[model samples]
Target: MSVLTPGDWGIEALWSALQPVWPGLSVELVDEIGSTNVELTDRLRRLAVVHAGGQVPDDAVLPVLLVARRQTSGRGRLGRPWLADPDSALTASLCLPIDRADWSGLSLAVGVALANALDATGQHLGLKWPNDLCLRDASQPLGRKAGGVLIEAVNVGHRRIAVIGFGLNVRHQTVPDRPTGALTEIWPEATPPATLARVMPALLQALQRFDQQGFAPFLPAYAPLDLLSGLPVATTDAQCPAGIARGVDTDGALRVQQGERMHRIVSGEVSVRAHATELPPAPGH
Candidate 1:
């Protein structure tokens, strides 16, 4: 494994490498923030307000990327806190304007894109429905979570901007009350910046495609990486019953087989373990 200092993950270095591929793309790197998602949301709101008032130029590009060395109030799905060591994780968020009226399956599409990108770097990552990246093992087929994605939308004028946030564990570190895994476990030489450079382009491409084609196009590619398929699982919601996981639908809903019927789960936290049992701690990232 190689050691990485904060100096190695410079914003200018990343921008220089990415500019050719993503021409005119804006990038910002901060030492610390409450949350990238929160920051981007606020920015989008201000942009929308300016655009609405016709005070902004018409030639401005739509997407902006923000990377943070540390997050004081990082968040995950269902309001979970995403905690990580400043040097051990890659935390980033992208604010992108979209034309889609229904953004139902964007999270699943982003997961597929990220999994493909990591695979290109010689790491086998799996998708745990909606938006979790997993490191699967034979004994723990559901896999230990290596990372996660959270997508939030803000309306800017008539456009909807999706704030896509991701947190990936790059090196080994202790995460209190969570079963976390790191990319270094597979790619020992991986660094936060190196991993980001590899994944960002793929993620951007996927988001663009998703804005045009929705989740249907990524269904086939996502199947091999789907970790919950054919497993008995339970939902976090008390009213939802436990069932056997049957993979996702075209719209990214989890299809769970309950008794003689198949039920579609559009949203909620799920676990492979029975509903009554306690779920293993998940990675804060």
Candidate 2:
């Protein structure tokens, strides 16, 4: 595969590479979008309406892969702005119907899949619980954030649709208020289209496996890449006291050891700073 330059992503190139891997998959490339996640969510809503009206087959799964060269208003977890240099980041969303009742740990599963795909290039990558991809090494105590996964679920009739969004920095760019890392820093040949080509198939396969087995099948795979294991951590939940990170349980909830008690945190922003020092409170406290 030839190395692609920055801003050189092409629909034809992406389709040619991904079509054989994912038969019948639909791909859309746009010059710019507010957010690929938002676009796919809207499309899924319209599809649900059409299905409800009996215009489309009920059992049909609408799988869409949308990629954007630039995102004007990309969003991360908790509605935080996901800013990246135009054409220098691989911003994409995958929307598909799944047959799972329990969606817990899907984000973690995605993180594992992404780490597996990128780590093949000889970069040691680690995952922060839930879904933050980081470049980790013995030299750097705190891992540098390289990418993230944001998942949103929409229920249509008895089926659930997932919109999984990915934002990976292909090149170094200024990310305000956070320490950022880029794939090109480790693999200088990395490019948006090439990175997407490597990651999308792995992600789709992982999602399918997760729908059938849930997060149980991914625990062992996630353990090695878990960056927060055996570390002091704090959470956005004010009532919850600081605790030692004990990895995730079978159900995907983060397990934090607070004194003699273990707390199963379902959802919150977790930080691995100092042992008892609280992180600056999130907006609205």
Candidate 3:
């Protein structure tokens, strides 16, 4: 692994590329942090407190991209620990305001954006239902998870702030019982700085499109990349004990075929595991 310096991130270059997409965007890079998502959420919460006092300005909630060179206590969906070796992953969080009546498939939309951005040809990368980026190949069969997305939203006065956290393993690492995948498996030249630069613009654009059109625009793009499609799966929800994965619905819910009925597994409701083989535990339960 190449040693990454602070200059490798190219903060100004990224700002030049992404500033127009999101006005008042701020790009910040830290040497190390506990969790980018937690930090951003805490910042937003403080802003919210300020707003309650009528002292907050209108431009207070500007879009922010927080990058951590080394994240010590990173988190994944469902309150699981996402541990990554130093300089081995692209760990960051994006905070912005999203105005939508329904946020059902936002995470799926984000997944599609990241997958398409990182692997435009869709040959080596695909999405696991809800919010995981997995490797596409015959060796792993059902696709091995190489990255993931975790989103947390908070109501700030009249607006809503959504903090989207993402992690992509750039180099390979060995975890005791957790089988992991790395971007280098497909892109041998993958690096944290370059990888972040590759995906940020697409992610910003996707969020903008999602705010206007919702998850409908991303459904077709997500289909070809659905790793769990047509695979037998089991979930924690008793209502949908075991079934075959039949892709996702318009709202991004996991469509599971159980006997003669179809069950739409909503996000955050239950944990799902593909039964085609004894898959490793996902980033989150």
Per TM-score, the best of the predicted structures is 3
Predicted candidate 2 versus true structure: per-residue lDDT over 79-176, tens digit per residue: 98886556578899987877788999999999989989999643478889888999885755548888999999876656788899999988888876
Ranked by lDDT, the better of candidates 1 and 3 is 3
TM-score, prediction 3: 0.92
Q: Native-vs-model 3 lDDT? A: 0.84
Clashes of each: 0, 0, 0
lDDT of each: 0.79, 0.81, 0.84
Write candidate 1's Cα lDDT for 38-86 as tens digits: 9989887777777885544434435779988778899999889886567
Cα RMSD, each candidate: 5.6, 5.6, 4.8
lDDT, residue 177, model 3: 76
Candidate 3: regions farther than 4 A off: 53-56, 268-285
User: For candidate 3, lDDT tens digit of each residue in 1-285?
Assistant: 567888888899999999888878999999889999999999999888878856555588888999998888999988888766678899999999898878889999999989899889998888887888988767665567799999999777788889999999999877677667899887888888889889988999999999998898899999999887767777766788777778887888898777667788885443345335532332222
Candidate 1 to native Cα RMSD, angstroms: 5.6
